[model samples]
Target: MTHNLQNDLLVRAAFSRPTERPPVWMMRQAGRFMKEYWDIKNRYSFLEMCKTPEIAADVTMLPVDLLGIDAAILFSDILVTAEAMGGQLSFEQGVGPQFANPVRSRSDAEALQTDVVHKLQYVAEAIKVVKHRLQGSIPLIGFAGAPFTVLSYLVEGGSSKDFKRTKLLLHNEPELAHLILQKIADVTVDYLNMQISAGVDALQLFDSWALALAWDDYEAFAHRYNAYIFSKIDRGGVPVISFCKGSSVFAPLMATAKPDVVSVDWNADLRHVKDGLPEGIAVQGNLDPFVLYADKKVIKAKILQLFERMRGTDGFIFNLGHGIMPDIPFDNVRYAIDIVKEFRY
Candidate 1:
């Protein structure tokens, strides 16, 4: 399962090894902005693109080939785990993802399929396909939604701004919340291990909604399950990245969860976060994604500014604070990557 990669900078940086420069990759690097992605998107539904190994692998490789990023993340959605847990998932035109049957009651929580690895075989197959296509060019990253974030979607049924229903359930039925999180955590551990066995070089746990909780709430609901999931996964030396947006306040708490890397959002200062986190945990991200909208000169300067802040810091991976927007010009992304590649330590 070893990949003889030419560019192991991302892998080395993830493991906190010294590198010539910070290896660059974006969170949603493979989607929307590229014409090739739309070419395929036009032909298939979102689920079809994710389920089809060939298409998924092709999409995953697009960023590496087109943008020259140092890593390839599997082109899949976090809700796929929800789907595997026997929830019905669909993507609408204006709306992103909707769950037909959400986990609202204790019965709903118990109904979630505990045996998830077999059902998610397509993801592993897609990873294998992506690995074959990558030809050891760079490391492939596998990821899943953190248990709490997955629980939020499962409870709220879709994307939520305030997560009112989710928090209500957490407050009203705390035991039910933990029960569902435990179920999801069990599945997450099995699911991530499967991805690793399929040959991915690194993994990330995306707790996109962790910011919704207060400190005590986050510690009880989010951090507890995240820490358990991280504990159960056997990384086998591959770095695990824990990312949560709007999470500056929880950086110190998150560091204790022990992900090999902590990906910060745009608002958090990279140096400040780096100093707070324990030694040996690498830092990734902090660049504003909107900065890509600027002209090439501005983009280059902004990239340099981030690098300047991160200068002499080991275990740094250059990435946007969050996913790239759909309407962003493709060339701007290309130019940004070029800037990161050209910059020296």
Candidate 2:
């Protein structure tokens, strides 16, 4: 499954293999902070950018060319899988994603289409374009929303602070919740396999909202399905990363899913979490995204501090604990990457 990549630091680190230094990249590396991203974003709606291969490739390449990041994630949204499963999806400028037909009942859950791979052909095509353009310079990551996270969106109909509707479904009717979760899991397995077949070098499962659940609920609703996906996909030696907003607390639970890498949040000490994981499991992130908004000296010091803590550790990747905020100064983002690239073990 190896490709002739000029910069294989990311892939190497993902496997918990020793490297000269930890490879660096940011979550949301190709998004709104860059004026170049806005130029393309202005030309098309967000979904349009995702659906169009050329435009998606254009966005996906920005970080690689501008910041010299070690990896490039495909330009797409997690909810696209839900949309393919019969959820009517849309995005308002600032309101984020909304689902017109939220699934609330057994009939609504049954209506979601599990045969979604062909419907998401645009994503696979975008991956092909991105791969051709990369020419094996760096790895391109393909991803899907973990089943519980997608189910929350479908049940809540959009973003929610309390996830009231979603939790109610879990409590009042556990059977329906599992029904919907299984459907999303089915689509996720097929969707991720489709990405693998399209030539992505690695895969990530984003359980972005996992923080919203308690231990028992998380284990029953989120962790099991995530493990199911890891078990079923034909990864073909392509490393998989399991990321969640609550990984600082859930790192142990997340590791049980058997991802090569577990991407954690800023709340925990990165080195401590790494030390607690099983042997050969790599770690990515825990830096506060706001560090990029600090002065150059502050940013440099913070980056150095994390690296120093992880000084002797193997299988570390430098990244923000979460996605970069849209308004973060682009110059500061570039400076942070420069600092990481210049550092060594």
Which prediction has the highest TM-score against the true structure? 2
Off by over 4 Å in 1: 1-3
lDDT of each: 0.90, 0.93
lDDT by residue (tens digit), candidate 2, 1-345: 766789989999999989888898898999999999998888799999999999999999999899999899999999999999999999989999999999988999999999878999999999999999999999999999999999999999999998999999998999999999999999999999999999999898999999999999999999999999999999777999999999998999999999999998999999999999999999999789998899999999999999999998889999899999999999999999999999989
For every model shown, what is its TM-score relative to the native structure? 0.98, 0.99
Candidate 2 ranges with C-alpha deviation above 4 Å? none
Error of 1 at 308 (Å): 1.0
The deviation in Å at residue 140 for candidate 1 is: 0.1
Give Cα distance to truth, residue 264, candidate 1, Å: 0.3
User: RMSD, each candidate, Å?
Assistant: 1.0, 0.7
Candidate 2 lDDT (Cα, whole model)? 0.93
